[model samples]
Target: MKAVLFGIFLLAAGNASASCDLVSAPCSTDSSGNTYIREQNLGGGYNTYRNGDLYSQTHQQLNGTYRETYSSGGYRTYYSDPNRGATYQGDPKGMAGR
Candidate 1:
């Protein structure tokens, strides 16, 4: 498991820091924290862990490639090369039934 600070820095909530793993990866994940986006802004991405569950998604251009992660777990990743492009369309995954 890797520790990654994702999304806009909402300040440190004491000890509830951000991390990256199988449940919370960097991609098109969503959150219950009002605003949601997976393009990994504010660095790369952020994952919220609680009750043995995870929620997050983020993407950013790294090394000339677009790195993306969906709520489809954290271990996997989809990267768009320098000239390639990709898209993900659907409701938020894992956290909500929608």
Candidate 2:
């Protein structure tokens, strides 16, 4: 029983470390004067929330594509390995944070 409790505690701690919840994650302002909030996704991506809403979600793909899906249902696909630029689709709004 003690080991089970310890395992549960460890799992919760790991989740807390990667959460994108504004109350838990660190926040910062960009040079453009926008405030961004960060969150971690359980899947293959991380999120940036702005003004209490999901501004963008950046995810990794098996084919080495890094895609950022924005609030407007738009996206930008980039290569993760070489760290190249992104190809935009849909209406491109900047990734603002919550």
Candidate 3:
């Protein structure tokens, strides 16, 4: 009886830990043959998603700008200017005049 209880506890704990891990895959299938997915960080950060042919993502930065590129085609970019406490967004461009 004690061994069974211990096994059950371990299984529950494992499940809880697994929930905090990052997941990357199709979450569901719709009637029109569309799929949805969510990508997240296990720790503490941003989450992103890709649905059908469209892709979108976001990130949490500690000090500077955060940038990411998608496999579909285009890219998403963001930045926080520490001196002015402002944020900027646009396509992936070179930082020369800033």
Question: Which prediction has the highest TM-score against the true structure?
Answer: 2
lDDT of each residue in 12-31, candidate 2, tens digit only: 87654333333556454545
lDDT of the structure predicted as candidate 3:
0.43
Candidate 3 lDDT by residue in tens digits, 1-98: 99999999998876543332333442433345434344456753333343434344445566556644445555545564311222212211212233
Candidate 2, run of 10 with poorest lDDT = 81-90
2 or 3, which is superior by TM-score?
2
Ranking by lDDT: 2, 3, 1
* Residue ranges of candidate 2 with Cα displaced over 4 Å: 1-26, 81-98
lDDT for model 1, please.
0.37
Candidate 1 wrongly placed segments (more than 4 Å): 1-40, 44-54, 61-73, 81-86, 94-98
Q: Which 10 consecutive positions of candidate 3 have the poorest summed lDDT?
A: 86-95
Q: Over the full model, what C-alpha lDDT does candidate 2 score relative to the true structure? A: 0.58
**Candidate lDDT (C-alpha), each:** 0.37, 0.58, 0.43
TM-score, cand. 2 vs. native? 0.51
Pitting candidate 1 against candidate 3, the one with the higher TM-score is: 3
- lDDT for position 69 in model 3: 47
In lDDT terms, which candidate is top?
A: 2
